[model samples]
Target: MNVLVTVTEGATVDDEFRIDGLAIDDGSLTTDLNEWDEYALETAVRLAEADLVDEVVTVTIGPEDCEGTIRQVLAKGADRAIRVWDDALERSEMLDVGAKTALLAAVVETEEPDLVLTGVQSADEGFMATGVSLAAAVDYGWAAVVNALEVDPDERIARVRRELEGGVEERTEVDLPAVLTIQTGINEPRYASLRGIRMAQRKELAVRSLADLGLEASAVESRLRLRELAEPESESEARVLEGSSEEAAAELATVLREQGVGR
Candidate 1:
């Protein structure tokens, strides 16, 4: 019962990060293992420690520089790490779900893990589609925003409690060889120990090229094209109508009416 977790590179905007008109300078970007995926990986590690799973492996797709991110997960207790990258992939926008799903699909087929776990969304793009796309590409049943999971290896069934709208939860059972996109707060992720960090640097991290995965440059076409990027608007300022209660209430009603708002 091998469990595979997919990790993505999360990036932070540095002080030097700025937009030159519509084009952002990504050279100032600093990358790390995604926070949400860390939770997913932690869930996998707990399952392995409980003897519910035999092994835990992590996979990611990015440029050679991404090895560091993979090692970070290894330090957290993943048995093996696989990084898939190529010049073509580096030149392309990998945040597109199609290319990402294809890369993960290749890895899934090669590894043949019984269960796959992923974060609900990546930190950088936060598109929230990669996990679902991966499940579809692999033709595996999937549960999204999973907060609680219980696996019965003997029955090959997994009971999952997923978060829903209005502070509600939905419970369902998924067969083995399925996917689970974990939400944050599912568990507290463990920090990498000093010894584990040192060992991770020495661990042999496997690099898989597109060719090694039987994929071509054309095969991983990014179906999504990005347009202009912009920052979100700040929240509207709070207004304090100064005066007595009746005065403030009258002022508020007048202000609302002026703003085309009705009570």
Candidate 2:
């Protein structure tokens, strides 16, 4: 069995964003791999190490700078890496659900992996749709928010436990050649070791284009448009109740009851 995972580029901003425009950072912060995607990749790597999967591959759809992130995936244990990017895509940093799905579907088609995996959501957009969208586009059964997975290679079946609201979990079995979006807390991600990093440097990171994937730039479409951006409204006044611990607890409980909470 072969598994493919998708990685996304996530950033952190130390200062305020450009509220008047798209609320984007001014490149003054730091960049890192998406936290959720790291968990997804770690799950894939564990499967590979356990001999449940014959190989693991990772794909990243971003600018060339994202190659570093892809290499990190390889160092984590993915047997191969694919970097999917184009001039048009690089120009439009934020892709709509349809566009991102199409790109991942193309990779799935090309790689023909027996299983597909991705982070439950991107750290930047937090759309929580890319994995399911790719599954739909590629016509595969999918499980979202998966916390655990088991695969039977001979039967080509995957049993997954999905996390739900209220701490409930649903277990389902899907055939092989399916997609799964992994949730955080599923596994702790490991950093790339020095030896693994050296091995990653020797592995090839294939760069793919939209054209190569039989896709057109115009075919990628966004349903939403950014009209304007602004900072969240700030509350100018909030009363602080000062008292001893016991008094504060009593007062807070009274306030909650008066506010129709926990009544």
Candidate 3:
């Protein structure tokens, strides 16, 4: 099986604030693989190790600086990594979710992997809508927030487990050539072994640009608009009360009632 893992170079809330000039400190921001995407990468690597998959290919779209995150995935066990280089994209000019999805769709079409996986959402934007959009663009079935995956390549089916409200799990089976957005806690990501790191250094990384994918700036859509960025209001300090068991219970009930709990 050939598995494709799509990753994004994202900024944290703090990083975004700093880039937008809302923060005073000019400290350089730290970047790492998105947490949810780490789960995706781990899933792909596990599948490959179990003989369920033959190769694992990781892809991402960002400036050259994104190679750090891509290299981290390669170090973890990805067979190869592809970086889509576009510096203008980092300036928030072509930052629309739909545009990004379209670019990814084009790349996936060229690669033609059996399974495509990604994080449920980027930590910074949290649009939480890219997976479905990319699937639609590529004309593939998509399952989101999948906590578990059981692939039966012989049967060409994948049984997926998703988390629902109220601590419930939803199960569904999707056919091959499907896209899945992995949820957190699906599995623990393993660190890169020395041998794996050395092997990754010899792997090939293919870079593509917007024009190479037959995309133009005018072809993208911006369904959402960003007006202004602001900091969240600081939370008030907590207050604690000490008393007898009964008094404490009563005080807790009073507080809950005042806060409109169970109203």
Candidate 4:
């Protein structure tokens, strides 16, 4: 069995920052491997460590600037990495879920891994739909919000524990050649050690373009367009109620009454 883990570069904004039109100012943002993806990669590495899988590969759809993040994946435990990027992707303002699905679907076709793993959601966009969408695109079975996983290669089945709403947990089985969106807290992700980091430098990190994947630039053109970007409007104000407990309770009641929140 083989496993492919999908990862992405996630960005965090500075405490004080300004918007650069539709996006945040580049200088004020820091990028790294996504939080959720770390768990997904850890799951794949653990499978490899258990000798249940032959190879652990990671795929990403980002430009060359994200090579550092890809290196992190290698340093952790992926056998190799595939990075998909092109002029079309760099030119586009944004790649919607469908566009991303198409890109990933191409890689999935080329790799043909027995099991696909992805973070439940990207730290930046948080769409939380790519794993299922990719499964649909590749005609693979899929399960989402998976907190635990066990695979039987001979049986060709992936038993998964899904975290559902309201503290509910559902255990189910997905057929082989499937995609599973890994949820955080499934395991403790390890940091890249000094030796792992050195070894990663020698690992094969392949970069491919859409053309190499037999895809055209038109394949990445997104139908969705961003209309606007602005800060959310502040709708309420806060007041401090400082005094005896009884006095504070009375003030809270008065404030609630003023807002017509309670009778």
Best by lDDT: 4
Better TM-score candidate (1, 4): 4
lDDT by residue (205-254, candidate 4, tens digit) is: 99999989999888778888877766677676867798999999999999
Per-candidate Cα lDDT values, in order, are 0.87, 0.86, 0.82, 0.93
Task: Write candidate 2's Cα lDDT for 34-114 as tens digits.
Answer: 998999999988888889998898889887887888888888888989888888876664589988888889999989988
lDDT of 3: 0.82
**Residue 171 of candidate 2: its Cα lDDT?**
92
Which residue runs of candidate 2 sit more than 4 Å off their true CA positions? 235-263
Which parts of model 3 are misplaced by more than 4 Å? Answer: 13-28, 87-94, 221-223, 235-263
What residue runs in model 1 are displaced by over 4 Å at the alpha carbon? 14-17, 20-23, 233-235, 238-263
TM-scores for every predicted model: 0.85, 0.87, 0.84, 0.90
Ordered list by TM-score, greatest first: 4, 2, 1, 3
Worst 10 residues of 4 by lDDT: 227-236
Native-to-model Cα distance after best TM-score fit, residue 244 in candidate 3, in Å: 26
Q: What C-alpha lDDT does candidate 1 achieve relative to the native structure?
A: 0.87
Q: In candidate 3, what residue range of length 10 has the lowest lDDT sum?
A: 17-26
| Model 1 worst lDDT run, 10 consecutive residues | 15-24
Which wins on lDDT, candidate 1 or candidate 3?
Answer: 1
